[model samples]
Target chain A: MTDPTALSCPAPAAETERVLLGHGSGGRLMAELLRDVIATELGTDPIAEDAAVVDTGTAEVVTSTDSFVVTPRFFPGGDIGSLAVHGTINDLAMRGARPVALTLAYIVEEGLPLDELRAITASAARAAATAGVPIVTGDTKVVQRGAADGVYVTTTGIGVRHPDATPSAAHGRPGDLVLLSGPIALHGTAILSARESLGFESEIASDSRPLHALVAAMLDAGGPDVHTLRDPTRGGLASALNELAETSSIGVDITEDAVPVPPLAAAACELLGLDPLHVANEGCLVAFVAPTAAEAVLHAMHTRPEGAGARVIGSLTDEHPGRVHMRTMLGGVRVVDMLVGEQLPRIC
Target chain B: MTDPTALSCPAPAAETERVLLGHGSGGRLMAELLRDVIATELGTDPIAEDAAVVDTGTAEVVTSTDSFVVTPRFFPGGDIGSLAVHGTINDLAMRGARPVALTLAYIVEEGLPLDELRAITASAARAAATAGVPIVTGDTKVVQRGAADGVYVTTTGIGVRHPDATPSAAHGRPGDLVLLSGPIALHGTAILSARESLGFESEIASDSRPLHALVAAMLDAGGPDVHTLRDPTRGGLASALNELAETSSIGVDITEDAVPVPPLAAAACELLGLDPLHVANEGCLVAFVAPTAAEAVLHAMHTRPEGAGARVIGSLTDEHPGRVHMRTMLGGVRVVDMLVGEQLPRIC
Candidate 1:
């Protein structure tokens, strides 16, 4: 995923010359690494969105890729396999694409149990099938026992762009209404609870499910009015909102009370000293819809099971370009800045 | 890449309950893992080729993926970066597809040198540009230091099938001719020498360049008559031939003297007690062309730099279906079987 924050942040210090865990935290450091190192070396303009569209002569093909190295492998609600499938699929959906196929790749440790690999593979297959896309091709490589974690999966998805939508992070504009599907922080909280053996395991579960169907419904209802669609993964809602604001050169104002947070996840975030706005969510979306079509889009979202909790949380503004502000319950407005570094790594 | 040997092997015993290094060795064990576990659980037919073609309603798109975990990260003639690009491109080329876009994904070990990451990214970019395919989209994830090696890369390539060709592993006929694009074993030997410090590093180099141009030339000359195309990567020539034979349900006959082996690679293989035919290759291809078009294809191959050492090495036969026989230099015939275990791990 592209990090628009790279355009606004100062150059990283020269002596911080090694890749830190923060570089993968979907924060300011990750954006700088991608912009200063990867993009510069590759001589390509920084990618500003989840998927890239390529003209295949006969049609435009949308492509995206992601690697899952979540610790513990077998987390509640989802494992690495389904995560791999759902992650890539959501990336395509963010681009308003209908995924046609996915390619799966695994980097396995030499001593991983056969049963573990089988279970992961089956989970990935079932997820793909349920999403109506096939795992058409794949690869598996084994490294020495100590050379890798149990297994890491990389899935690449190919899709056809939705004809009625042209959603992008840079498409947001003043007056566009922001609508969020479902709740925030469930995924990040579930992962943290599972990883640390926290007692809240039974109370929180990952929202790691596919969101393409919900996205499709939004596009069908709003057509070209669906200006932008984003999934709050990795850096979560705060980073995603910041990226959109910076990329679109627009400001966003949100009503804190309207942002839904599942009670369990909110409690877990509070107890863990984590910001719910900076936590990853797998099965939801943040959409910027033209105000004229907002009600229709929200209605369409409510028709889908994945989007039953959809509601308007904010609206784009022109007051503070490239900034996000929230109206607190205390009636004061506070700037919602992006996380400076990683609060959690490998949450995805 | 797919291994057709799964169609010929007997059922694996239930006692072998854990995954072995050989499961990713590009041999019989790997084939069984794919067929009996991955494929069976996924409810799909076993894949028997390098890439899969998905009809996009408007065009046929070929997709393939591979993850590189070579030890030492850098090796003679190529590093993990270049290997990743060349590997996926070669897979797409093997399917008569002209690559259009590529995706690069990285799983980095925390604390890896930023300089190393930059170098690898630059190398991958250069390779993709050389192949005329843009790295359109990508992803990066960081793991704890001990959770992974320095870095692993998974590249997925998307391409458009050639309008004039339809080459496939199962398209081989009894009278088809087998041609080797160049010498084998250089890649595997170079990696081994680099990894083990075997003193042959100066004398051996990996033939790890992209071969899509050479494949394009062959397709131009033979068109639809080019029955099949495969790059002898992980399992090398012997395994590739076995796969072709088994997939097409035909026998293959080879003259040992006709298969080209560079003097340095041959010496390295001998000193290391390895068979050149059983080692991996990255740049070369094995093209099965009809006898009537063999001369034209060979002539066209000679016009390309990567195919300068190309030669007719074998022919498909009907006598012993699903078997390969090599006539030795001394006039003795022997069965050339697939490698039962890994001769070299992480070779590509």
Candidate 2:
């Protein structure tokens, strides 16, 4: 566990006199802000997990909340409305929860096209229906024209925990196998294309979709062997790995060649001078499972459309605990660090 | 019940081509948008209550979500952070729920002062602690400098419903007595004063508070006789009464002289050409109870500091169903309609 004292101590006054975009970038700065500011104020050590599991007397329930402020409301594959629902659902899935209901709160700017709002609502409703989750309640607030962007959606999801599931980032142990479900970086690149209006020859669409069913499949197959589950979102794969390492106090060794990055997304990243490993993926997830059940879990994941491209990319190690290392395609080793600054703000 | 066919029909092309601030004003336009646009797409009747109750197998739970976009982050009595917590908690309380946990999601603008964020977080933490509700999960997102205001906080609260409570707006019956928990319009006036920097002879502080304790007391005293409970927020007393009337298909007759309104708030509303009944109140609530239990509920409410100014303001009737009427101080009755447009935007 991270030292409680270290987590509570305030960051240097000079380092964070004001909040930069990086503080919300799901990177090192965001981690620091959450640990030193939010956690300190709450007088608790930061859980640093995607969702919090609470025991509701009769059952263990998981709940998660996320606010979506993506630049262009409509991206290549999904809009902010669907993204909001997918994001929160994904968080609950990461905790091995079967989502039951969701609540949406919208902060809309004055004078937004009613047609646009209607389209977004219809899209959100469809997404919820497709996921078998209902938007049970919602609230809407409007600010002055210039006080806000077109709209911001925040979604909170409630789900029932899988009966046999007990996944946590802190459960990863030495010899655990690390798996990546599908490709990475699609979401970030797609949003950038839409925001910049840069049409590429091969369109990169966001992989934004609900993953509760995929998670349920994995749990049904691997059970308690699945040590940890995480959606590589805002901070992408590198951040997810680093977080897992830090939380479990274990080291992760992975091969760059084994990580999956779609050709178009890789090309887009290269052209934009970005790193694929550090870019966000809305529809993909990473799982740390017991080596004994690694093959079974991978097989189960392969049977699902969302995880058809699942592969074993890494393994937990005793060496260099609390850090992540990646082997280059050339057989050279390099440290995979949490993103240092804002690479792309509002990408998720 | 409203006509399902009418709700499903899209608004005439000429009537609403875009979303106006009034659509989020918690008034007639906002109700129309929710019923005609949002609810229609979801394939469910609009639930005009503060929170939605869901059965969790072993226990019934109530959940609510609210987005706080108050202009001045810091107002007379409280800041946006505390307001966010109190607002969601009050919503749960209105459903007769004992708040268990909360999830907070913050959308912040780039370059906001970190000091401000920390202060707000600390305030929110204190408020949650005071209410005995833990903020179990949270997420933060950041937009570019000009893309958003300083910050908007969305809070989702989860609570276990009281065993004997079955409060709902549709539960109001004819002959039920209306009660005001406290003064009206203090929150609106205080926010306006802070936003416009208008100095009043005497400071008018927002009545921003969590009301779960008072609500519990009322439930304890009135039990099933307490037909409904609502916090007079954005659209204030008039809007709350109108919604109850419509939901129950009953008439509400109130007396302007009997409703509690702080003298300072009344003066501020008069100076600003605003109706006290139409302005918001963050800490107050309106309750409809059986005539037999009215005195007991009011007495129990008066014992609590939050409801010290409680008063019997009106009664429900069969005449003029789905409408509200107010007997003026001059002994003349007049119709009280929901506000037609935004009275004060972003006042929490």
Candidate 3:
């Protein structure tokens, strides 16, 4: 296991002084901040999972939180409101939990159009209704015009753990196979195109959909053999896989041809000189399944709309434990490392 | 019952166009935003309770969320960190829940000092530890320097419901007695003084504390007799009483002299031309208890440090349903109304 204290020691003097955008990029810097500062001070053990499971003496409850500050607030497939709901729901799903309730908190800037706020609220409500989870309570705070962006949404989700499932990033075994639920980088590409007006907007739409149903299907088929489940969100597929490998103390091997990427998003990534593997995704999830249930899990995933793009991208290995190696399409081996700094900020 | 849709009516054109600081002042505007917009769109019934109870088949879980963006980051009694933790915990406690876990999320401005963030994190950790609740998971997102203040902490707390307690503002009856947990307005006074450099720094400290223990004692003593429990945070005692009166369709009658306000905070409010009853408070709570159980609840409250100033401040009456009135020391009665607009912004 990585020592949480070690992440603090090597932080450069400059990096340790002022907060950087990279510190919230869901990359190495973000990880360092979480472990060295947040975890150490909060006195909680670091776990490589999207949500924490609390045994409430009766039933285990899963909880997670995320803040959405996506610039522009509105995007192609979904707005910040919908994104906020889906993001927290997906986090609970990543832990094999059935989301039960969500709480919405808004940090709205003064002078933000009330009509716009209404629209966002409606969209969030619709999203929650569609997911069948109720937004049970909410809080709103407005700051001075410049004190905050238009609106930043923070969503906290509560879910009940599935009795038959127990999934964790640290549960990955050496022989476990890695699976991708859907095409990668669509959300990242969409946000970048919209923000920079890169003209790829019409072609790429964010895959910002809820993945709890997809997770439920996979859990039904794989049960405890699902080993590990994670939504490749802010740090994307590369970081998700790296986190699992590090937590499980196993190496990962993937084939470049096997990792699914939408053609339009791929072209956009290539044109922008961005790595598709390093881009963020809102809907897709990465799973490590035991060899015995891999095929069944893949078949089950294919039956769900969100997981139609499911495929076995790689397998956990005993070699190079704690690292990921990719077999390039051109027959060359390369180490795939976690992102070091900001790439697609606020994509989710 | 207040018709939720009526709040959306007669909203002046200018008011409907953009959000004002009043919409977040925890007053009438904030109430309208919640009932007319958030609740209506989300298709949920509004309840005058700090937290929502979610039934998970086997257990009832209470959930609440709050965002703290108090300016200056640090204040006399506590910093934003402890406030974040205490605020959410008190929300759950007000709903008669025993906190189990909390999720902390931060939207930090890019240029904030890391040292400041560290201090805040440590303070939050200490606060959570003191409350005996673990901050199980967290998320951090950094926005551009202009996108946010130094840092905003959003805390979501999850707690198990107390079996014998079922408190709600709507449960108040005409015969119920209103109780004050402690001295009020210190938080609002402290924030205002610190923000304006009003030189009352040493004398006034924000009563930013966790009140779950005090709540537990009250619950143990009064159980089902505690009709309503609300933290007089934003909009202070006046707003809290007004909300309870409206929710219960009853009238609240208070004696001005009986309301507990710290001497220094009261003086500060007088000097600033702010009403102590309208100022915010952090640690204190307003409870509506059955008349027969009022003395027992107050005695139990006084047993806890946080509730040392517990006393009867008022009682519910049928004479002026949906209104609050205070009998002045000079033998004059005046109607007290909920705050209309922002008195103090970003106090919590």
Candidate 4:
């Protein structure tokens, strides 16, 4: 027989077996461990199952998956469970697919209380219902104490994309009109101020939202005139816009005054030595429209409560391809760069 | 303007911010972060045309997504990148979908060497090509140096599901023959032996594979007789069987003699105090077939290279719903339990 050491599981208290950054590496190591131990043992699929089953339809279906690893597990307006469903659905909606079914995969730490899990699950179900999506499948697994945080949920969603929809970074072209679905920075600021370090509170709360309805409306009003659609997520507006600029090999021009920045977000950015344009925003979208159709697109976005705050924030440019130059309040220009670092890591 | 304290990003470099178990909790805290930050900011709906354009689909497609968080990033048979793609494609095929497009989301640490990132990406691309899956959309961001491992990849895949085929856990029924597509435990044993503390030398390599072809064969052969299908992932065969038993609410009686075991896997398991039954198998599958169609199913599986080691490992029983029993080589009965803790982390 092999030495007992060779057969042992990592002890929760053992410093050597402690969690490392490599645990998150999307490498063979993570795959093997998850498959052989956690997933198989948990009675779930070891290989990821993002889009498993979908009904064929006239509206082409699009599916998206997201894993939430935000700290605290609770915040101002929403929690992880709700976020899991909404985030994935929004990903599909961006492709102009009406959100449909969802699968929730939860990795819960052993010591997590039943109440919390139940609450999260309940919230997830509720969120799905609220967004007109169904949580058709789910899985739960327990990690050894200290092996993980309370719980981590990976949500996979399937939706139907509109036939005329052509949404991707590469589709951006010079002279496209850039529009905002709503105000920026509320979500990031609310969560930040909630932190103990700041111990500050305001009317501000996360601007979490579901975008399927909003997307449906925009697509309906704009038809094929919409050149691109994206929800500014991790790296926020700057990072997301920068990616599009580079992909389409076009420059973008945005006016600081034109972009909607709620006062709360503005106040928070001033103190943090950060740029509001660079800060993160949820419940907001950046759309590139045919310059001629910009007015119609703006009108369509305003049709929804979530998009009421929407406005024309910028436009694509032929000069300075692959650059994003923001117009300051003083009418001067400043370049927007991808977040020097994620606006907040582990935020999602 | 807010004070500097209020301006600071919620996730500071404080030791507490490094990582807390609460971060994984699927509660309100986690949700708001994802909704407001990750999903809201970077993942804007690309269909809006102002942000970016993402393809919905033209052909039937299969898509899957998973995050890698295994403790070790390297194993004997593979590393994280290769495993990421294989695990992904395998999932797509399990749904009988032919994989085509993939989206890679990467979270990198600030201080990671450029070479490591390049290497992992290359490996991922190679694996995708090998499986005939191309990664057309990707997103990358860097976290603080210590916030994450060198990198973590979350791959979302899209493929076309097999026509006229239905595969779901709910499909399993009573009195069905069970077929294991390949020899098991190569993945588990390889990872176990590769542990730093339990160092042992064995030719054991992870059984990671893309099982689309294998899936196709069994479906074609079984025709209408195939009742259910599943890929034993994370916890190994025992966990998978246990989960299926619970889901199907049926008893599973397997003959140790009928289950194919590679000599190396068996020897390694014995030496390491691990049960080969609880080990993970990637390039493997467990199919349930009606008694009348069992022969055709077996014949179809063995015809394929991936199924050469296929065997009739067991059958479902109507009695003792939601339980599993094993007939040992000595004609003894034993219960197989889901894995309690990780046997080896990241054995995908």
Q: DockQ winner among the candidates?
A: 1
Q: Give residue B254's error in model 3 in angstroms.
A: 0.3
Q: Which stretches of candidate 3 lie over 4 Å from their true place?
A: A1-58, B1-58
Model 1 chain B poorest 10 in a row by lDDT: B47-56
lDDT of 3 by residue, A1-348 (tens): 998897776755542242333333222343454455334432344322211223333456788888898876888888999999999999888888888888788887876765566678778878988998877776667687788877899999988766788788778898999999888989889989889888998878889999899989999998999988888776668877876787788999999999888888998899888888888889899999999999999999999999988999999989999899999999999998765555655665
Q: lDDT for each of the candidates? A: 0.79, 0.79, 0.79, 0.67
Q: Write the per-residue lDDT of candidate 2 for residues B121-162, one digit (tens) a residue.
A: 778878988998877777667677677788899999888776
**Chain A TM-score, cand. 1:** 0.83
Single-chain TM-score of chain A, each candidate: 0.83, 0.83, 0.83, 0.82
* Candidate 2 collision pairs: A114-B18, A114-B19
- CA RMSD, predictions in order: 17.6, 18.4, 17.7, 11.2
Query: What TM-score does structure 1 among the candidates reach?
Result: 0.84
Instruction: Tell me the docking grade of candidate 3.
Output: incorrect
List ranges where model 2 is wrong by over 4 Å. A1-58, B1-58
Candidate 2 chain A, poorest ten consecutive residues by summed lDDT = A46-55
DockQ of each: 0.14, 0.13, 0.13, 0.11
Better of 1 and 2 by lDDT: 1
Highest-scoring model, lDDT = 1
- Shift in Å, residue B203, candidate 2: 1.5
lDDT of 4 by residue, B306-341 (tens): 888888899999987777789999999988766664
lDDT of 1 at B93: 87
Better of 3 and 4 by TM-score: 3
